[model samples]
Target: MVLIDRIRLCLEKLLEVFTVFLLIALTTIVLAAVGFRLLGASLHWYDEVASIGLGWLTFYGANLAAIKRAHMGFPGLVGSAPVALRASLFVISEIIVIGFFVVIAYYGYLVLDILAWDRLVSLPSISLTVTQSAIPISAVLFILCELLSMPGAWAKMRHGIDSEHEAIEEAIRMAEQDLQESRS
Candidate 1:
């Protein structure tokens, strides 16, 4: 368990760094595109490349979210389950989530073959495969994140802990603290 925690920590840090790099690159590209457009030297590849970058950002951000367990969930529903049923429900939910990503990764890989000869309309030198590789790559990353986080998630579920509720409660407590400080 400690080893898994350490691995998750490393993966989380790596993802954070990569995602920040992607964001900076995307921002630079957009600013350059805009600057060029204003100078009447519009970049033809701007739209396509920016779109691809955004897709990459979303996919990779999703993996980060998966590792952090920050994705949307009906925690109340899950936490409300009877203790006897909670374990089964948790397992079923995990299997469904993981299985869905597996299918996505499989098809994403197959689509790369179909797009092998294709190139971006504005940048013929750049293969469509390169742009589209984010699909399969991020899907695999997400699955890995999901698996790495499962033990912690199982522990939480077994104890009927709802992360969402916990987050809200924490926020409320912080707000109350601030209010008390203001009063003082």
Candidate 2:
């Protein structure tokens, strides 16, 4: 259990780093695109590249959002349910989400396999598989984060913050604040 926890932590940190790098690349690409447009020399592939980058950014950003519990949920509907029903619903929902991602990861793997036989249109140096690979990677990361977050959700259900949830929440809040400041 301890080793598993450590591995989860390491994986989460790695995802965080990867997300940051993608965000930086997205920003740079957008800025460069803007600059090129200003000079009346836009790269024909800039829009396509930006679109792909945006997709990667959104997917990775979702994993980060899950880590912070920032992903939207139907809390109001859940709140109106009876206690026993609510608990069951919550568990079922998580299970469904996990299962859904597992399917997505599987299909993503298939897409990646197909892409292995092709290359990007403009970026021949990069395989299409490399781009599509983010799908399964992000899906698995999301599943892991969701599982790790179960204890926190359980804590909230008991109307209290477990120490683990509190610690993770505090870290997430701090990181969010830093991100906001950087953006400003």
Shift in Å, residue 65, candidate 2: 1.4
For residues 48-91, could you state the per-residue lDDT of candidate 2 as single tens digits?
68788989989988987776566767665665667777788788
TM-score of each: 0.92, 0.77
- Clashing residue pairs in candidate 2 are none
| Residue pairs clashing, model 1 | none
lDDT of each: 0.94, 0.80
Q: What is the total number of backbone clashes in candidate 1?
A: 0
Candidate 1 lDDT tens digits, 46-85: 9999999999999999999999999999888989999879
* Local distance difference test, candidate 2: 0.80
